[model samples]
Target: MSNSTPQKFEFQTEIKQLLDIVIHSLYTEKEIFVRELVSNASDALEKLRHTQLTEKEVFDDNLTLEINVTTDDKAKTITIQDFGVGMTREELVENLGTIAHSGSKAFLQALGESGAKNSNLIGQFGVGFYSAFMVAKSVKVYTHSWRKDAPGHMWSSDGSGTYEIEEAEGQRRGAKIVIELKDDCADFAQDWKIKEILERYSAFVSFPINLNGKRINTVQALWLRNKNEVKDEEYTEFYKFQAHAFDEPRLRLHFSADAPLAINALLFVPKENTEKLGFSRLEPSVSLYCRKVLIDAKPKDILPEWLRFLKGVVDSEDLPLNISRETMQDKSLLEKLNKVITKRFLKFLEEEAKNRAEGYTEFYKEFGVFLKEGAALDFTHKDQLVKLLRFESSLTEKGKTTSLADYVSRMGADQKEIFYLVGPNRASIESGPYLEGFKARNLEVLFCYETVDEYVMNNVREFDGKKLTAADHADVKLADLPKPEGALKDEDVTTLTKWLKDTLGERVSEVKPSDRLVDSPVIALNADKFMSPHMRRIMKAMNKDAETPLRVNLEINPRHAVIKRLFETHTAQPEKAKLVAEQLLDNALISAGLLDDATAMVARLNKLLESV
Candidate 1:
């Protein structure tokens, strides 16, 4: 090939095909073009740094190792510069124009049978370098080799058909790439935007990354440092920077594992949940890293969906990266890594719960939903995450909460069930008749306020050898205490229950003395196996045309004044007794959240008010 002014080179057939795929579909986010280019520049600088250590007479030894980013808004062009190993005219043609120079083909060719068998890479197609054409109309790379006599050269390509190579004059000993962004992608031409993309993807690059002469990646990758060498403030700063949060982390787990898979991780629970404030569902925020190089930000498979709230970085050394590091192949290995790290983080939580009770409580208030989700959805860690849960219980003071372990610790030997009640607040639960028998037995029951809590307990089923029982369930049995003085006589009470059942007829499943009554007169119990009060509410709310039928256990406390009087007044005045019984049942139904027809209850209550 003879060149008069400059030589234009056609890409190898394979590379041309690879370039088309890269420019069209290799990346999901167009901004990745910037990161890919910056990473290449950083790699060149890193190689030059290693070369300077052993080489006595290095070319352009005086040049500093730094990355300079300049954005030209007027020209809609962005430039990335690094003082690293560059290339000469022929080197530029061989390096930038072909895929063989990347060391990928030979590495794959020489890949040992066992090494190739290990499925731990993300990219292998050798087209990641061509991703720049996704958002750039044209790219110009100017580079000078490290050799003293090597002349600087410029490589220009429109990324359409061909690229040109020519000798450039007075170029520094590094690589400078200029990208002319396409019209729609002009946002990269702003200095602030480039700085953000650099900080997110290349913040841990071994060398300094400067934007418009100001240092951008100042924070060191603390995960790579020795645990003792990192100060607490540095960790906090990293957490704030990575989490995009202002408050100190309520909990932090930082550790390293080497056997199963070499992994270093730093995780944090924020001070508050913005989602709890009625914000949208949170997306996964943990970043996956291989040797401090970001692989994927917000990777879905790295952690379970239940861990979406946790924020931090996980740097793994055993991660066999594909060329681009965009995805991973060895899922079983990734699962192993996930298991090890998740277990360790949970163990850290356990330690925090024991050693830092107050701190854990604060964190629980914010991130407990995540644990609840884990308990309900992640069967692999359900038992462990269940133990990590905390809730306010009858045993704990108001505003204080008790964990499942604590509740189990306080459980009586006779109590085989871990009882919980879903309600709007503490007052409503305490005043409800279902709790009377439980309270009389001095049994502690967890109080759940959110709709998801019931769904969680229902899914979890049991924890630590005790069955998780809903305190409001009609089937839950409480020990019957001795009848109070002035209570209805046994024979009369029996006759009255029989007649009330007969009178209420189809509306009543069973009219009987509740085994769990103390202060309240009567309570309605739902006997439907499939539909809980909560499930009923949810289903009814969702379907406007569907009707929810009422089927409940009408329970009577023999000792309560209202029930005692109703028993006596029933045979003496059958008509008024009917009204009084209906009214009493309505009042009980209101408390139990079973009687949907509140119009009738309201009418009866008003009538009774007039009689009074």
Candidate 2:
């Protein structure tokens, strides 16, 4: 009994289940074992760094605080060593052998709750040290405590349900994990393989990381750096390295928040939108970090879906991470982070739109569709997003665009609604009869070109207290223009309207003399307040046999020559007048994009030609 022998210990039930899950399924990528172990070593070094300020007569005080990785492909082994606060035999039994005695969890909670303003806190789960078993056939950890009188010890495990601990000599002041790689997992022992994994997940570790005697994490954590001191080239390099992007960023917002939650974020808008170039939809790229250590490279709910195009890093010391640190634990805290960052980014866009109008116009040409999607779908930021929307209008030039705020500023005091018209292009919208009324009264109308514009406007509803009204909507009522000379008399106009209604019957909801029209003979507006021409087109696109029967109000321009002649022809020759009336209505229907079959209109035109 006097002779020293290794003492064996059995893992708790929870520890066994956790070990199996971590080795097999907890982490999707096997290479993360390196990251997890490196992170643990970094945390141990950080604790020693903090402990030195308070304690005197520490063990191995002269040891450098850095991590060293020595990979041996011949022996199929990877060894990670750190010179920090090591563990005692009793400490090892409690931390490594017990399920709930996690030093990282207690340390991180203290760091967060204390608000000590240190960025070295890394691991959250106490089980991160066990992640080495994922690729290790056998693992040995040699550690020496900081207390000068404590003896060195070695803990060895095959990860087959039992572990053994015994005294060891010549151990360093901190922990050294020696992993014997399995046959299939031998690649982890290669120099290039471990280096790549280190750069991807642990590049931002507060402590220096060396792989096979070569320094790997040379890039600084720029998000934590002060903006005034950070150079543009530094940000560019960080963006390229962090986002894996080649081109320079189009826009960048580096900000920190403490109110709703403590957060430091550096977000970038890339020069090109890959989705616009017909690439697959982008996944989230804003990596989530805690104290410079990578947590999740692509967190789904870290930001809103609309901000998925953004690339950069978001670090929050306040995060209440789960045991794996792979997924967030508090969803409400995550939502708060999302709202704060999204609002800040939207504010950045608003500034860009105002301060650099030309540059923003170029950006809008490429990425504005995303903003429109958010405006319609994200209710929390809809108003701010709506304000950022730019569109060509009746008053704007061919390529120029105006914002809703700008449109409202140009509105007359008598104007009560913000008017917009949806069409294929500016040419089609300007040439349409619906624009004639607005043009005559010197009123401007926004020109919407995309099919989604209708949906966006319908969902946005209003902006800045002014209702967003489609100019072609059936409910629109324009102010009366002065009556022109040689126009049809009041009685004649009334008689023509009644005759047209009677002849058109159910095809027309009601016929009326135009108070808004100036030169156009007729313009059709949808009678169903809910359905616009764009809505009808959307319905037809969804279902081929969808019934889009026309139900519209027909307005006749009393001053137009065609209508004056039609009134005279109505009484002189009722038979011919009916054909002309039907043809005129069909022309208006064609303009509204509601004419289903052109065969009837072609036949009617031929009959009228015969009469001529």
Candidate 3:
């Protein structure tokens, strides 16, 4: 039943070079060889399954369609057996020793053209089998073709140019590759090592995978299944398994697309934002998979950095990857995958906001910072992200939030801008002088509390064709409200403003009678068009040079009692009035979060009290 003589053959010229690259320099991680071998087994099994539908009288037809892996630490040998379609002697020689029809020629040509920079172009040419030599001192493939008449054969190679093939007795229907591990790679023969590799890259493969009689890939690839058939509990289980978290997901998006790269993505937002809880910055967790085999576990470029909080998998069958399957060969296709997934996720958020308002609000409370970051930095999705931003406004009750679309809906027909004020919280913004003018005019101003809000608003710039203007900015021009009785005369208001400007000198860029102040004596707006007072304070906190000379466009409410009295006191008591003017500027600076020193204000306050 066995042939005593073995037929020996030299490897094709290109295959010799390929073996050198694959064995010596191709893969960054040696463990990738496990994934490649298992993926090849899966492909073989899949082919047999398709063939079974059309053909009859197959060899080892009674054998179950699965992959079996065995590791022997003492012997330093690892064996992977697939009970699927096997190979004939001629087929083995053609597949393993030659490059004529295996596409290895084109692969080598591409490698030569791209040089070492593109050395990762391995898997494109169906040479995944060569990866075995990376860890093996010698490799043996015992196979029997599925055809009833085909005989069993064993192909052996030490990966030094030539390989030997001989007839072997009692072989199974599928290929069984036995790798005699090199001394340095003996760890590959450990059961735990191979098990870990199986669970990571091949866990979601269609067929069952067994290691030492225990099933490894028990969890199914739910993303590939119909959404209607997948239950909530099943999704939850899969999420916990994939994300390695105990807490349930807050939101899940399970979707697939045919066009734009045949994508099947399952993304989850965990119940808690770990980064919000003061944990270390999150890395991208959405793994990239091609045909159920993981390409990258934490692919940095799969999604925009702002979306790092998301956890799940994005599998595309259309990826054009190189040999190691380590790096994607086509960058534009990867970008397309990013765009498609991002837009779909954004659309899901919009639907959730529309149909489940309360739930979306809770999610926004925990994860809104990420959206703000995206809105500020990701220009491609800025418009959609801006619409999803929610904030409390003068018109909404405290704790209630309004979307930009809702805010735009409530805007007066003549209102030209969306006004917002940044402060530490709602109370601080409401108490600030800037809100009074908008409140009196019945113009709603959004309350922005987070540190990133200003940056988001500044970058988003506009929504619904209305500019996003900071309420306290110097350039803001609000609709004038009716002047109440007992206010200072127009002439006196002008005189007081001119006198204050002359008294304050360089400290005041320009003092003017306020159209935007209703009840407060004064409000200070940063005169520097480039930097807001809030931004200046942030710069100072970061220890950057924010000490550009303090100059503010001070606006005084003519109706306030202090301003009316100051108009009278300036002419009668010039020294006292000058002290009052300086104190007011400092008060405004403190309120604007721009005051660097309060020593002068304290002295001025003591003098004013003594006079009183």
Candidate 4:
């Protein structure tokens, strides 16, 4: 160290303006300074690592390549030391005192042109290092050039207007920034505060980060690694760490993409769905990272709302963040990113369903609601999401599931539409009249148990070129089967339907002989094309005032014993037959989950018992 005297220099005009903006308005959160500084240190280390491959004679060759953060609450001081490529005296003047190489000149120009409200432009210009002035009272940068002959120097600034530089002794090969914390920002000097900030934003930095001699970033960025080399246990551990979850992941998708946008994503489906377990609605848990540095912990636009159940990380190097690195500047690019990740995840599900049927079935049982939501709402991925949907069908064993594609493949050439029935469970759906004719004809029908299943079906509308038809809908048309022995004649069936419609009055929209019923006495189909019985019930449960009046197309099976008896009793015992007709409509309503009041049915049943 030759010069004992310090040399002073004034900051450039742009630097002076930048200091004011950064100190007062650049970042919304004051603690972002720590992330900015740490990110810069990691960048320097990465550059040095690349340089090490070519240069043999590096200064301080024995120093470990790591970042150490020390905090002293007693003295209100925090120091960040990184053993990476440092700067010389002239380089410090060029880097810190002027706006030439730092891109501050352009940043200032853009800031002035667009005004402070348009701050997203700040990120396009590199000004990360100056973010430290947000909380620092006085900043001291002690650095030594990586070149062997370069001397150590200390650059001091209070970020007012000017700075001083002086030769120093015993400085390391890299930069060490000591920040004298302002009185209002003294919390930053606390060990716990810094540790929290580091773990939140800098946890996945390529270089090791140590806070107060304890490692902060221990978990690796598994998304960026080759899938074949990563162990299953490692994935589980990473999922638990990233998701803050205890149970092992039910499914994991770790993938990388180069085209469209360079992206690396590690997504996990938790072992249990918390929302299904009666927990509060899930928020978006998949965090967004830019080059391994966390940009947003819960980025709302990163994924569709239906994918809120997923937990993990999505890191892309192509992201251009604003000055605070808090939000992305290019919205179209972000949308492209969303499309890519969503399509890739849906593709991953397709592969899982094809190659690992049992495991996919287990995942579907827990997380299938989310896929259904996506299938109903996200039109961009509806085809793929619909393909990933699983359902128990009349053809499959209990608890077994089939994909839409598989269901389509099993369909006979004569079948023109996909058939499904919604009820409380497999037993209710099987016992219901809606599935009888399909079962009699050996036609498979999907059994939907959840309330959302109807809405999903209604929105998805069609899959694999076949219309998704509700078996209970009045519009359904089934092929005729051979008339069973002892069935009502066509003339008697028409007369019975007309008499029942007159007896039931407005309760029945239109009574007719059914082709979609084989053994059941009668079935109630919703008359309204827009609202099904199940959907009406759902609306009533949510808001009673929202419920609409019920109108049904009652279809009676001509071949069933009850219908034959009703046909016979209509003219002989008219009052007794009226009671039977009312009771049958109520019974069908009960099976369809459309019954609002049973008082009338109870009184009618008493009258019928008296007549018997």
Candidate 5:
């Protein structure tokens, strides 16, 4: 069958160095050689697929475009054969015998400089075929080019320094790689091991991959297909297979982008947050891919940290991956990918919030905490994240919520700031004195029940040009309400406030008549502009020094009966007025969550009771 005597050729010096690097230090996983060989076969098949379109006649036209992997545990040999485009003797020497590509040469220089720790540099140099040197004591590649006129050839190498090529008889139309597994890497010769590797790395390959004639890649890479043609059941199936989740995804975003970098992404928001369900914090689940081959299963940098709840695949043909395709080389491109995918998902949420209010509200109920985290931490998307924020407000029914944009739309022209009150529940915030003034003036105050809401508000600072002002802060200035009839004279109000401030002394920052209080007898506001009550609580819980005691301004409603009586009692019974003033201050402090030690307040309350 030999057309001429077998010819032995020394590997190009760079190929020798590359072979040494690959065999000694380049790859961490020896089994990855299977992946490399399979990928090489796939590339050959893909090339032939393109070739068939342009050429009129093709050799072995009836041969199916599929990969067949046969493992022989007994012989300790694994053979992967693809019935696609094969190489001629000259092509094999050119492709396999030398580092013909400049990229591969540069890769070798990088590997040499880095001491061959860069396993991620494998596929970049067109040296994916040489990875078999990692596990193979000897590798034989029998290939017949896809042209009938091109004769069959066999290239053999021990991967030390030289290889041999000779005419081969009765060959097929594509390449078949036979790896004689090394004694230490005999596991790859097992059927189950190869099947698992194929399932992990090549499950979504465009061609059928058969393990001993049984098809393994049963699922398609649905993200690559036109989404309209993919059915709902198909997408659900793909999600289940890709995410390994039993429950269905609550939402899905299937989109493709052409600008900046070509991206095809299919992201899914699960039915429940596993972390919220008492599971550990979720890791990034979005897999990264290039041309249907997986790059990284859990790409840490492809999406922002808050998007860890998302599960899906992001594929970009434009990504410049290092040789092994394990790590992405272009950081800016990855950031662009992150931005594009995140921005698209945000736009999708915005659309859902506007067009499907109830669905978005339900989603917000489950996943809004993540959005709050992004709004507080991710400045680039803060504006979009703020719009997606939802909260119960003074005007909404107990369970109902509204967005900042919606709140702004309902804002009175005279209103210059957005108001929000942080508390445990709707009833608590409404029952408290803070909301009484806002309610009286018909100013809607957003109700924040979760702890992160205040943090989000502080960082967001403003939305649509309206300052996000906490209702309890002393700096908040509500429009003055009309003074009702029977209100105390200005002189009398001034006298009562001065007497109360003097009695309270250091305990109160300022005691004054409130222009905002209506039905409430007294309202409290935090005087420290820098620290809100919630922030103080957070600091205390964290054991961080507050550095200053909480100080608050007490505002009295002169129209209320308590104040009217206090004004008279202060002149008649100064001691009793003192007890009442201390009691009022304690009550206000309790409402504001600033009361650290309440023993004195209890003693004061008993004394006031004796007077009553």
Candidate 6:
């Protein structure tokens, strides 16, 4: 591009293919064109910033390095202009009109030689300039190089196939991009609409972005900035903007890592879990960025699915994006990123739990379900996630929480298994006979109340070398203890056990003396030991026609006072004893969630009361 004449050239084969992808399928959202152009502008400003540092004879270094955007609905055009490192006529032709040789390569080479690994370079691939065609019918680039003698040029392109270059007379340093909007994308020429897209996507760009001569992107890239320089109010405002959340963030993690990969990230946990409130499940909100430019505003692969509750930004220069797939390669490196960030967050939780118990408790009450989900499903960080889980247990007061570590610390020397009982609540489990033996032995048991607790427990399986077991399982053999005074004798126990097995028949898998019962007269255990409390509830809820009637092992504490009384009464009044046996069995069936026949139990109780 020279002042003497103008030359038009055809695109290269690779440029044509790249243009097809960029215009058709490279970006999922058309609004991304704005982000790409703004990013390119920021890169130009950054290049000027570096050029001033090394070169003494810099031209127009006084111009403020900012991106100014202007939109006009009447004209159906939008203009994004920067004031740093404008290109010369030949430079414009090479950088915009064609992709033969871009200063971007030289810019990258110069910055890389400076030993500044993260020197932000824009237009590395030369495809960002053409993205304007996604929403524009034609585009014009006006620029003057840092060299004072070099002439400014205007490169115009419809981006259909070819572009033309000509010299321009009056131009400041840096570049000005004017977009002639397409008919379908005419709305972008409106100030309000373009401002909205700028605020949503490029709000945190380092450079000042002004739309219609007014500043729009005012927020700085907090992720890349020093944490000590940031304020709580700033973090809160950022969280609100990034997450589209009105409430303050419950927790936040600001971190930077130079090893493994050069990474800088600021993550937030919202004050509430919308999904818990019966809202629609949240899509991933944490965005991915390189330097200050957003690459993916809703990246699905940056974090695990269970971490959708977290919101913020993750920016890394080391992340090599597969331009074709828009996904990252080197999964192991991604895992490393996942591990480093997750570990830092988990460590933050441990600190919060220790130093700020009340606040952490509130956060746990709202967002704890997600941690449990990760612990149960994400094996990569399961161990770390498990430490963050908290639950109410038999040993804890109401609303108090105990972690697996705390439970393990309190376990008796002889106890080799961690005990947990799944039920509606503490009262339900207490009312049932499951807690009797643990209570007698002064052992603690975790109370799982949520429906997903079963799945969590199964996936976890074990923690700290102790196997997790259900307190009410049939196979759980309690330690032998001395018999109580009012218990049935040897002969009476044998006869009663025989009579119970015969009377209950198929309903009773095996009637025997109870090892788990200390006060309760009888306890029923599932004959199909595989069916846990959670499993039974699932089966009952899913398939109404399931023919598998629950078979339970009926066990009676021979030494209990109720057993002694029942033994004497059976011989004295066989009819009353039969009714009592049926009532006891019904109680166990109800506890196991298998009792469909409540009508008989009521009638039997009425008959017994009348006789009394």
| Candidate models: Cα lDDT each | 0.77, 0.83, 0.85, 0.85, 0.84, 0.77
Candidate 1, residue 464: Cα displacement in angstroms equals: 2.4
| Steric collisions counted per model | 2, 0, 3, 0, 6, 2
Tens-digit per-residue lDDT, 1-612, candidate 1? 223367778976655655565566545567766666676776677567656754677788999888898999999999989899887777676676776665334323333222322211112222345667888899998888898887777888988778988777778899898889999889989988888788766665657888888988864778878889987777776775565454677777789888788888988887767567443466677888777656666677778888888889898887764423344677887798789988888889889888999988888888888899899999998878998888888878888999888898898888899999888888888778877788888999999987789899989998887899988888887766766677778887789899899888888889988788888888888878778887787787789578888778788888888888888788887877887888878878778766666887677777777766
lDDT of 5: 0.84
Clashes of 2: 0
Model 3, TM vs. native: 0.68
Compute each candidate's TM-score over C-alphas: 0.69, 0.68, 0.68, 0.67, 0.67, 0.67
- Model 3 ranges off by over 4 Å: 1-219, 321-326, 544-546
Per residue, candidate 4 scores C-alpha lDDT tens digits across 1-612 of 536789999999989999999998876778867877886787677556645645788899788889999999999999999988899999999988887678898777666655665453343355767888989999999998888899999999999999999999999988999999999999999999998888766766667899999999964777889999999977876675456444688888889999999999999988887667544467787978777666666677878899998899899998853313334567787798899998888888888988998888888888999999999999888888998898999999998888888898989999999999998899988878888889888888999999899999999999978999998899888888887788899999989999999999999999999888877899999889988999899888889776478989999988899999999999999989999999999999999999998999999999999987
Per-residue lDDT of model 3, residues 451-496, tens digit only = 8999889899999899999998888887767778999999998899
Highest lDDT against the true fold, candidate: 3
In model 6, where do residues sit more than 4 Å from their true spots? 1-208, 216-219, 321-330, 606-610
Two-way TM-score contest, 1 vs 6, winner? 1
Pick the winner on TM-score between candidates 1 and 4.
1
Clashing pairs in 1: 121-322, 122-322
- With a 3 Å backbone cut-off (N, CA, C), the pairs that clash in candidate 4 are none
TM-score: model 4 vs. ground truth: 0.67
Q: Give the per-residue lDDT digits (tens) of candidate 6, residues 283-366.
A: 777877766655666667778888888889888887654321245556676677677777777888899988998888999899
lDDT of 2 by residue, 344-425 (tens): 9999999999899998998899889999999999999998999899999989999999999999999999999999999998
Colliding residue pairs in candidate 5: 120-324, 121-323, 122-323, 122-324, 123-323, 124-323
Please report how far candidate 5 places residue 265 from its true position, in Å: 0.9
Top model number, TM-score: 1
